[model samples]
Target: MKLRTVLGAALAAGLGWLLFAPTRVRPVAWEGPGLPPSRTSGPYADNGRLNTAELLAPVPGLKAPESVAVDAQGRLYSGFEGGAVVRFQPDGTAPEVFADTGGRPLGLRFHPDGNLLIADALRGLLRVGPEGSVQVLATGAEGVPFRFTDDLDVDRAGRFVYFTDASSRYGWPHELLDLLEHGGHGRVLRHDLHTGETVVLARGLNFPNGVTLGPDEAYLLVTETGTARVHRLWLAGERAGTLEVFADSLPGYPDNVRFDGAGTFWVALPSRRSPLLDAGARQPWLRRVIARIAERAHLPLPEESMLVALDLKGRPVAFAQGSGSASYSYITQVLPVGDALILSSLHGQTLARVPLAQVRP
Candidate 1:
């Protein structure tokens, strides 16, 4: 090839990239906090050792099940992308439509009064009783409506419900975009059933994913996905009305946090961060370009089926990993019932029911 012709082609390609590719995403600048080390050894050395083949309770016609609620009768319940809350048998078979939420549901918790409460991303909070009737709970706090209600937990006495609004700038569809922007529009809210009031506990959270009360119900644990940290909001104590980091430097961005009755806090990590994402955190333009490319390529997701079990004091205790031979990924929550840890996935068709005995060392 002639040198002049080669030079002309290169110039034209560069010109095209500068014009078309740069504006594809047009993302705003967001310098995210430097990510922690990829691996933490102390209590997580046994990560990714769980046997995925043993779990996997099948459900027919369920799509993108992400949250689970085990009723008093051992009935398993989950929310699907199609705005339906389903009830399943103990072994995770036999599907029934417990209630049609008519909006995307993301979190499930059973009230002490036998009511199934839900954090619907599009419809705010909801309550479904055994009669199969659905009622709207709290939709907004501080005079503003909830934009992305993510997860919730009822207090031990069922007096209050703590929940998270993942992002006020993004709805259910633009979660990744919100992450890319590093928007701190997330918040933790409390709904008092007695007072019939919804109030904001804390604001400016970075993609807060889940909310659960502390062991004694004196404080709340909130997962900040963009920061890969968990925070505690004290309600009654020396630290009451104060917020502090409960767990920091997580292995990956956390999604949901749950407290098992037996003193374990089960946390779900949807996926491990990539070097590309880290670089994008520094270069906003690069993140936009990467997002466009990923959407177009139908990329194969990097799976890290990682779940961390934290002690009641917010210390790491156990790590349940299923990286090997696990077809399911993007775990959103893990509820410990007896000796089993029921894992819900954001894009999986079946729920995982790994034995706690197998998850621990």
Candidate 2:
């Protein structure tokens, strides 16, 4: 009888804590995408195309190469979780520290003037010179400051830098929490290199993760990861100053997207859609509860690597996935360099690559 009474008391305490835990997440009930198609069907049909991927340049201290930039000389540059921007020879050898952003760097792009632009999560937008000098470019737009400067792209003339602020309500540490909230707190901004002026192009987006310039700089493609959709913001032509959906119903949560300059866009999927997360999307209270618990525990995701290739018309041209025995997972960026696709990840020490020919529809 005594043991039963004690167990009941503990159970009541546990229930009370779950019901009224102090959490930063203010989940707003929103409809999430339906369950994604199985890997063997629909637009995500698995074909073992990425099975031939091979790891390259495993540095001892470098991990989570979330994004990569290749200079004209073919040297590879990437940022890690530890605020380092590392450079590697064209052959993926001789790892060297190029520059340190002193904050988390998410996206990298080289300007026509030979400066590297970085979208740092903590320090906002920055630039690194050819001789390895870091410069603060922009930390906010208009009067509002950025909370998560995620990814960026530069025009050929180096006049403007297009980038995304992943969220305004959450910092890098609370990214997952922002996604859970499903609130529209993201924005697309452009920075003028010549005038040093910053402007917000679009605002109130849901977790806009990646941005890329379309052919001829006519349009910009920004990925809204929370919605599993990509938005097309027209820059020139009759559609200029308008926003539309470029692609929707992605198979997984996209991280970074890049244009190949050969009429294709590659998108990286860190992980497939989480059914558990989707199930609670319409239940704000449940998501808040889950977020509270998630802050203290890790959410396990499937061990599958995926990438999607889309044509200029926003049609899926190819879907690639690693085989079950594949070593690469948690991929964040798929950069098409020459005849190969360089794969970056957020949890591994090595970057992987596969021949472009191996990725077929």
RMSD of each: 3.1, 1.5
In terms of lDDT, model 1 sits at: 0.80
lDDT score of residue 275 within candidate 2: 78
lDDT of 1 by residue, 90-183 (tens): 8777777888899999999999999999999999989998987888988888777888999999987999998998988778856766666675
Per-candidate TM-scores read 0.88, 0.96
Which ten contiguous residues of candidate 1 have the minimum total lDDT? 18-27
Clash totals for all models, in order? 0, 0
Best by lDDT: 2
What lDDT tens digits, residue by residue, belong to model 2 across residues 1-361?
9999999999998888887989888888887877677767777887778776788777787788899999989999998888999998987888888999999999999998778899999999999999889999899987889999999999998899999999998988577788888889999999998999999999888899999999999999999988888899999998888999898878888889999888999999888887777888899888888888878887655546889999998899998887555647888899998888888988868678888888863
| Model 2, CA-based lDDT | 0.88
lDDT of each: 0.80, 0.88
